[model samples]
Target: MFLFYQRSVHTWFFLCNFSSRKWWNEETVAVVTGGNKGIGFGVCKQFSIAGLRVVLTARDADRGQEAHQKLKHEGFQNISFHQLDVTDAASRTSFAPWLLREHGGFNILVNNAAINGVAIDEVYSKENNISLKDFLVCIS
Candidate 1:
């Protein structure tokens, strides 16, 4: 698992070359959190195209379903959607049982869920002769 945080979104990517693995089949499930948009959505699409069953999860059900529909419209039928707020205990606890029952548990997990915990101080950074890149490097 590799996590990259940028612009308040935590983008997670499973860092294995799936194409090289013969065991990765249609029944193999990949769960992607924050799959409503951006890197998460792209990961979902790639996994779907690669013939793996993909569970696209988001904190917002409406957005998650919309993304699932978009993938379906693009002719990818292997994608499914479930609402998951990783920050909430109830949501996190319920998801495991649901995933086990629905897809026999997942083989891959992309932990792309995040909350905006950072507020950039551009003025302060400038005054201190700090570049945005330098600030990000320091924080991360």
Candidate 2:
């Protein structure tokens, strides 16, 4: 049996009982969107630890590259980075073909990208002693 857990607005994590080293091979691929930080990053880390070839993607190249570096520094070699903007139809439409051509095909996909749609000014947050992340966590 598998228990599905919701991680973020755009993410769902699946926990399965199946266990076998050969079940998922080196060719297994996973795409994680908005994986530069927070819950997406956590999901990417877990997938990498479980031996999936993780493609950690973000809209911003710099943040995605930073995450790739941090994961590499921590000794996770099964992970890589790509840039994707889920909200853009042009970007979304191109990803599948790109994945199919480059990695053959993907077995897992995690869509963890969403805009909070709130304008956060750091100065105001600091003055109130509540960060955007903290506020979101509290409200959720």
Candidate 3:
């Protein structure tokens, strides 16, 4: 049960391993949030290539479908797509049951959707001596 944050192209991901059992591609069902691009996209690709049935999710429908198509076009049959917004509570509530029903079982979840708190202008940020925590506040 290890957790790590994978950062890519200014996007942050919360990745967790759900179980101790090793993953087998044919037997595994993986859900990767924000799979339209960056780390999420790469995760989807790797999982599909490994023979796992991967559900690639993105907040944008068009983007998600496009990413799905890109993988399919690349000749991977084990990958699929769904629209998801990880920040939304209602969406989260709906997605869980649907995944269980549709996929039969889930073996992995890669939560790659994220919110970033950083200035786009590196020079200005440096000049102002702003740290990352200036944008991210601890909930507790």
Candidate 4:
């Protein structure tokens, strides 16, 4: 019983040391798309504060660069900028390779880019008894 107890303690010690070594040496990288402003920018700031290397991307180069500089000026040196237009395949292909080359690997990717549109006529028509499909089609 004493031998068995000693073995268990040794095993636990070895596992703890191994896990600690693995975690201590690992670097985490993150990318936030549409991160120059709004929610994406907030996420980037949070990640940078959390010690992750963050790349904030936007469709406009100037905006992306400006955001990067702003974060840096704010003492978040781990943040950088990249131009990404998700709707364009060419842009995605170019950025993917660049990301892989620069960051070894990315542990996080925040896709916050979106489009919102609302039609007042569609809303009024729905209130006036239009079908759901028709309402959706009208909005589209």
Measured against the true structure, the TM-scores of the candidates, in listed sequence, are: 0.69, 0.66, 0.65, 0.64
Across 1-140, the per-residue lDDT of candidate 3 in tens digits comes to: 33334456543433446576654748689899999998888888877766789999988889999999999999989887778887667887877888888898588888888644443355557855655555555432
lDDT per residue, candidate 4, 6-108, as tens digits? Answer: 3553321112224444342227887889999877887788777657788899988898899889888999988878899876679899999999899976887
Better of 1 and 2 by lDDT: 1
Top candidate (TM-score):
1
- Candidate 2 segments whose C-alpha is farther than 4 A from its true place: 1-15, 19-22, 116-140
Q: Order of candidates by TM-score, top first?
A: 1, 2, 3, 4
Per lDDT, what order, best first?
1, 2, 3, 4
User: Clashes in candidate 2: how many?
Assistant: 0
- Model 3 scores a TM of 0.65
Q: In model 3, which range of ten residues has the least summed lDDT?
A: 7-16
The local lDDT score (0 to 100) that residue 62 gets in candidate 1 is 91
Candidate 1 per-residue lDDT over residues 1-140, each given as its tens digit = 33344556554444554466476788899999999898889888778866899999999999889888998999989999999998677999999999999999999998987664432344455656757677889999
What lDDT does the true structure give each of the candidates? 0.83, 0.79, 0.77, 0.75
Which regions of candidate 1 fall more than 4 Å away from where they truly are? 1-21, 118-140
Quote model 4's TM-score: 0.64
Q: Estimate the Cα RMSD of every predicted model relative to the unseen true structure.
A: 10.6, 12.2, 9.9, 13.7
